[model samples]
Target: MQTSLNHYSQNNEIHKDIPGRKEIIGYGLGDFGYVLIWTLVASFLTYFYTDVAGIAAGAVGTLMLFVRLWDGVSDIGMGILVDRTNSKHGKARPYLIWMPIPLAITTVFLFTVPDVGMTGKITYAAITYSLFILLYTAVSIPFKTLLGMMTQEQHTRSMIGIVGAFFIQSSALLVNMITEPMASGIGGQLGWVMTGTLFGVLAVVTLYITFRTTKERVGFVPTAKQEEKVKLSSGVKALFKNKYWMIITLFCISYYTLLGFVGAELYFAKYILGNASYFSIISLVKAVPGILAIFFMAPIVKKIGKRNMVLIGILSIILSTFIKYLDPTSLNYFLIGSAFNGFGKGIFGAMLYALINDTVEYGEWKSKVRTGGLVNSAASFGMKVGTGLGTAIVGWLLAFGGYVGNLSQQSDTALQMILYLNIHIPFLIAIIMFLLMWLYKLDKIYPQIVEELQRRKNE
Candidate 1:
């Protein structure tokens, strides 16, 4: 290990290779696979559990809250595992190669509701969802950590994020456009089973490409002694001490909490808007603005800085969502609000991974220990908590409002609750995110941090 460190120090020049367009596109392709699975589960899973699989709303919500809580715990464990790993394939990229097939399998199982009774079905949901979250954490933590490992240039990382957003939103749009129609056309449980299988296959292929094409630099290979000293407690301590990381983690939790509104859209469209297929239209509307936002994201972040860009984006969401709340039933108002919300989401989404990557650097600079996996894992932990809580809110709110999945049309109380979950709740969360952004000042100090790290490395 000492020899390895000396070699790395002596050959610091070897780390300067910039990723070409092919590599960048390859990296972006990984997210295409990732979001295909993620968007499907995040956006559609709750609806599938209740409306399709015949689970009660409250049960589904409670199940998700517990599963996601376990998922959060596993995320931290996966992070530490990645940090401790020293393999020929590199620290993070190996998981991309190994886990895709299992991820695909679990995805299929998640959608394949059995012919068992309610107890059986709930058990199936728990078992399958747990496995899926485990596999997802295994792959996702590594994939996210890859950003920091791939390059040290902030601009390059930002560009990778931009390209990635294009693929992520594009995959999400495709899923939105196709998932419902395919499921409905196929007639029952088999429809969802088929949809999951198709996306799962695609996920495997794209992830393999990512594993093959991307290379990891800035790799931290710990000595046995160093590894022995790297306790989970220490990693957790390092994470909390970094103010920037704490701020970003909070931002992620809030941002994703607002994003929980996506889970409610299928119900909103089916019950409130009176057309399940309208989800495709709303998704299209949202995707276009997000794609457009990607085009301007890098430049805007470079100009006003990440914090300011995020502020602008969150404010856009709050404003548009508020407008939608005033008149929730109007088609034009819904579309218009969705467009602005998508635009804002696109900008913030593009900046977010890059900002998190910055936090890894900030953490290392502050703590003198480079644990990219733990830092990114901490961020992912927050996101999982947000996702679980957000989904729970939607579930519990629907149950409280007398949502009955088997009914042709919901009661007025249920529709009103759907409206709140769809528009107003997220609007409030966006305001909280805006407040969180004010505490993040890393963008102002990042350059100095980089230069100092470089100086220390050379010395």
Candidate 2:
């Protein structure tokens, strides 16, 4: 180990190559592609199920829960496939290239509801949604793993993640601003079909740019002894043993849960606030501040570290909770509160993928096997499950509160339920996320972990 440390410290080429500006921006475009579709699904799928397709909220909720959970579980298999893959384009990058068009096709299929009976519609929803999730996993896990493979250095990886988050938030902003109005303007299923198609074309283009621009600089080449120990069961066990990974996974679940229910903002805007068009305005308020906040991420993270910056972001969320509490009905108050929410999301979003990639080095150092795919897969699992539950909660609670769709006025119970979802639940989620992030101690030891991993690689 000492000899390996000396050898690695003496050589810069082994781990010190920084990606160029074009490369970084190109890599970032991948998330733009991803979030274009992802935001659409997360923000409006529930509304489509209920108002557009005429499915019962509870049934849609159940389907979302089951399908998303299954999708989360499938990430494990995809991770293993990524680890074992030996492609010319590279393990993770190949998926970015191959999966985009199919993924785009599936995205369209996911939105296209067939003219059929209720059961058939449900089945169509299930099959199409499931296929879409599977394809998303195939692309998403690799895109995530590509961050770690892009560079072993934390700073470069963070830069990549920051750029990526910009795209994610920006794409989300674009989707949020247009989807509702576009669909309404187009008037009927045709609106959604056109929106999905446009986004799909854009997704394919950006992803191909990602494939063309990004290069995998870091890869694991295990010796015979190391290879023997890095089996599937052992890799899975090693992942569980990573304390930082566990904390981040839990945090991701909580974060994505919050995101899952964010779609309910449309309902909040339409029914509770009495204007459906305000959904765009709300999204505008939330997204613009969030986009601007990303510019501060590098400096703030430098000053306080990623974990602390995230903690501060959570505090911002808590503040938004308070702001909304003052007057949930006032569009003025809601917009003000949403600005804070966007700011927090921006900070956290900038840090999240970078933080997840950091865990890979820690995992490799402790386990003696580099399992980037597996580590990221577990994180994906948490995200999917959290999103599932979050989306389901909206449905279940709305159902429980006796929600009726397409009505000019909601029952008192339903209105109150929407209020709690928008106001109270975020507060609880913020607390949980804050606590989880507080428990995260990885940043303190990350440098040492990377140094140690570098030594092992040299050995």
Tens digits of per-residue lDDT for model 1, 1-459: 112112222234434676767888899999999889999999999999998899889999899889989999999999999988888998899999889999999999998888799999999999999999999999999999998888877667777888888898899999998999999999788999999999999999999999999988775554443456467787788888899989999998988877766979888788878888999899999999999888757666667887888888888898888778878888778889999988888877678888998998888789776788999998999999999989988999999999998699898899989999988788789888998999899888887887788787766
For model 2, state the Cα shift of residue 228 in Å. Answer: 5.9
Best by the lDDT measure: 2
Looking at model 2, the pairs that clash are none
Q: Tell me how many residue pairs clash in candidate 1.
A: 0
- Least accurate stretch of 10 residues (summed lDDT) in model 1? 1-10
What TM-score would each prediction reach against the true structure?
0.95, 0.95
lDDT of 2 at 26: 94
Candidate 2 per-residue lDDT over residues 85-167, each given as its tens digit: 87788879999878999989998887788879889889999999999999999999998998888887665666677777789
Error of 2 at 88 (Å): 0.8
- What lDDT does the true structure give each of the candidates? 0.86, 0.86
Residue ranges of candidate 2 with Cα displaced over 4 Å = 1-15, 220-229
| Regions of candidate 1 where Cα sits further than 4 Å from its true position | 1-15, 221-229
